[model samples]
Target chain A: MSDLLERLRGRGWRLTAQRRVIAEVLDGEHVHYTADEVHALAVARLPEISRASVYNTLGELVALGEVLEVTTEGGRAKRYDPNAHRPHQHLVCSGCGTMRDVHLVTDPMGALPEGERFGFTVSGVTVTYYGRCPECGSRA
Target chain B: MSDLLERLRGRGWRLTAQRRVIAEVLDGEHVHYTADEVHALAVARLPEISRASVYNTLGELVALGEVLEVTTEGGRAKRYDPNAHRPHQHLVCSGCGTMRDVHLVTDPMGALPEGERFGFTVSGVTVTYYGRCPECGSRA
Candidate 1:
């Protein structure tokens, strides 16, 4: 994750200790953590990282395109995906709120017809598929 | 919209004045309001409906599947679409936060191939297309 830090540093990001730890906690593949989760993880490392600092760092990372902020349906907490470089969709478990990153061979933007454009300059699309995870499905 | 209230009434919903006003505010076609917005409109009519009551009413409507709660990116306030009887997607204005109910010719759930199911028993899908509304687009 130092590679990401170096790149961000090269882009003029002031790498404070809290921001560094947040980057570390969110570095792995298929990892999506809410701000609370990030704060909890960051606290484990720095022990003095404030909640506001974590939130600010995460916001900065997202604004710099270093992380992607993913908002799922119905629930309040927004999750962060480190895989901003990847063009992918998300599958969220309705029961447990577990998120999995998945890619499709087909693009979803083509699903909207030209007639349905409704005069709004369309930019991008987010497709979230809801389901139950293996553990959650079995109990149901 | 009385059709919805009657259906709910037939289902034995205890139709309180607060719930009834909330239903009335959300009854029209292509209507989606955040809880605060719902409370604002409901208060204009009832003048004394509490914010908690508005939230509770909206929550019950979602639990009953009488309304659909849509959460888009970067927006903390979730909007409610009462047109839940028919299947549709959403196109949201990133600039002004305006939401429009739209139907697509293709079903988004069909886009996910079986191989990428990732051990989740998939249930449904929601697609939110982001863009600027006409006024916002023109401004830009």
Candidate 2:
């Protein structure tokens, strides 16, 4: 069982075979897959998994805070990120939309002063760094 | 004429009545409207404006680097941000999806150490802060 499956099991989540396979597919470093991508991957493994099941499972995982939903670009498909437990930001390649997990040294929330709060109780922050990866740069 | 209209005109962009109304709707501080919203606003000014025109104009503006596209949540509508000329970040209200322009004090690029680059030539960064605004907080 994957770490996500174990965590879900610990939380008393019912472990269906379909859910197990989807969780297994999501367990990895820097793994970010769109719904269609996840459905395709799950279909390759289980062959009977439906797209609706994949979408529902992904939604449940996100609602449970076990998965993070990320959108690097507007009008693009949302990607499912399994690195929710780890504290990190994202570095995206502008050319190919490739994203990698990056750890930042400074507290980004601290950069927003009180005057800028605008009476909103700020809770969280996400920093997305954009650039061309080596492959794209070389190709360009 | 709005600043965006002036800039577009200076670039030799042909200004139609529909395009002028759409650009006027997009000109303001912290103005982030979706294509649907832009169409609705433009229709108020030009009754015959089509949804296709609004989307096309937005695409052209984004391609021209005069407007920025922003998506606050996965599976949500993409918002067109007109503050492309200014250097700033975004603060989003998690409850109502209201976004405000925010200026950060520190250079976020500096926080990413060289070892974390993973061979990607990072050129730009966007930091998005999420929290509930005063209205939502009070309602809660």
Candidate 3:
């Protein structure tokens, strides 16, 4: 959105064409894309966009708290999500790499007993559940 | 530890010196070492351990279900842990990278409401809490 672009400009970020394309690619519902994926998508719109530029823009967005970086199991490539305004978890499809947002109705932090604090303040908690999707399961 | 090596060998893994040193480096209570950190410790013993070997052995260990690879908040180098027998979450110190195992008294999976399943069978869940350690807190 223009508001997001204006906020980035206010943060002293250079509003180049490459950054704009990356931002546009990331703005949507259930939009989770890797850096390389974003680069591919951005290149479709702006042919001159480089992979390094996509990586840089995604890193800056994460640092600015406008995006969240998710590293799934097996040390795969990090995925970027722009839905940082709301708190939620992810349900990833192991077969297709498709990810869907699942908002937790019960606060996961509330389950942490007081005895396990270990003198450190608990700031936030994230939960990720991995499994086969319905389509994948039917195939199995 | 000999029993573990024997089980690993039974799984068709070659018992090489590089693998031995990597296993020893990860053997202990509450030990979580990154790949480079494991390489540093492995080299101290074998002196010929390559980063590739450390990576290979770690991957093999995870496949064998003898070790767990943990990727904390954001995408960082994966950390290896030898405690595969227990069900626990991590309490990681954002400052020192110190990790402690904290058992959740409540079943977090059970807390997920039925409507949020998204038709995927949840296999497992991992929770990580990030905060400053006592030393880091005092410095701040």
lDDT of each: 0.89, 0.88, 0.83
What TM-score would each prediction reach against the true structure? 0.96, 0.95, 0.89
Clashing pairs in 1: none
* Local lDDT at A99 for model 3: 83
Q: Report the poorest 10 consecutive residues by lDDT, candidate 1 chain A.
A: A131-140
TM-score of chain A of each: 0.96, 0.93, 0.92
- Can you list the residue pairs that collide in candidate 3? none
Q: What is the TM-score of chain A in candidate 1?
A: 0.96
What TM-score does candidate 2 get on C-alpha atoms?
0.95
Alpha-carbon runs more than 4 Å astray in model 2? A138-140, B138-140
Docking band of candidate 2: high
Better of 1 and 3 by DockQ: 1
TM-score of candidate 1 against the unseen true structure:
0.96
- Supply fnat for every model shown: 0.88, 0.88, 0.67
Task: Give DockQ for candidates 1 onward, in order.
Answer: 0.85, 0.86, 0.64
Least lDDT summed over 10 consecutive residues: which range in candidate 3 chain A?
A131-140
Model 1, B10-54: lDDT tens digits are 999988999889999997877989999999999999998999999
Residue-by-residue lDDT tens digits, candidate 3, B1-140 = 56789888887878888888888888888898999999999888988778898888889889888999998875388888889988888888877778888888778777667688788877777777777667668444
